[model samples]
Target: MQGPAVSGEEEPRPLLRTMLGDVLRRNRREQRRTLEDVARAAKVSMPYLSEVERGRKEASSEVLAAVCDALRVELSDVLAEVGRDLAADRVRRERVIRLDVALGRRTARPARRSGDTYCLAA
Candidate 1:
C-alpha cells in the first residue's frame, strides 16, 4: 500500500536544527573526543560548542565549517544536508502555490487545451 500523502507547509526549522545537533553529537561520541578537545580543534569555546550540540544556538556557517573540519569531515557534507532540507522546503512552497491556484485564491492564467490535453500556460 502507498504511504500517507504529504502536506505542504513551511519546513520545520527546529527539527532540522535538532537533526544537525544529533549528527554532531553522534560523530563526536563515535570519535571518543571530549567537548573540550573538539572546541580546541574547532577554535571555539567549549561552552559554545556545547550549546551548538544542544541545539540551543544557531551556528554561523563559519563556525559550522570549523566544527566540521575539527571533526575531520568535509564542510560540504553538512552543507549538502542543509541543501537537501532547503530543497524539501522549496518543494513544500511549490505545493502550496499549486494549491492556491487550484482554489482560486490566487490568480493564474488559464491552461491551454489541445486534443483533450490541458497544459499550463507558459
Candidate 2:
C-alpha cells in the first residue's frame, strides 16, 4: 500500500505495522514457536494474532505487550529495532535519490503527470 501523500504525490512509505509484524514473526521463528503457542500464551485468539503478524491489524498497546510477554521479549526492544530499521531505510532512499539527481537520471522536481502533480521523496 502507498504511504501518506507527499507534495500531492503518492509515494510508498514503509508501514509500521508491516515492520513490527516482521520483527515479531522473526522472533517467533527464532524461538521455534508456532502461532498457536504464542496466541495461547498471549491470551489472544490465533486468528487475531496471525492478523497482527501479517500486518493486517494494528494491535493495541495492551495486546502488543501481551504478545511480547508471550514471546519472552521486551516491547521496548522491539520498538528500538523498528526505529533502527526505519532510519536505515530513510537513509538508503535518500542516498538513491541523491545519486539519481547527480547522475542526471532524474531531478528533484520531475515532470508533472497529467494530474499536474509531481512526485519527490519526502
Best by TM-score: 2
Candidate 2, residues 17-95: lDDT per residue as tens digits? 9889988998999999999999999999999999999999999999999999999999999999889888887765442
Model 2 accuracy (lDDT, Cα): 0.83
List candidate 1 segments past 4 Å from native: 1-14, 79-122
What value does the lDDT take at residue 18 in candidate 2? 85
Lowest lDDT sum, 10 consecutive residues, model 1, at: 1-10
TM accuracy, model 2? 0.69
lDDT, each prediction: 0.73, 0.83
Error of 1 at 35 (Å): 0.5
TM-score of each: 0.54, 0.69
- In model 2, the runs with Cα more than 4 Å from the true position are 1-11, 95-122
Clashing pairs in 2: none
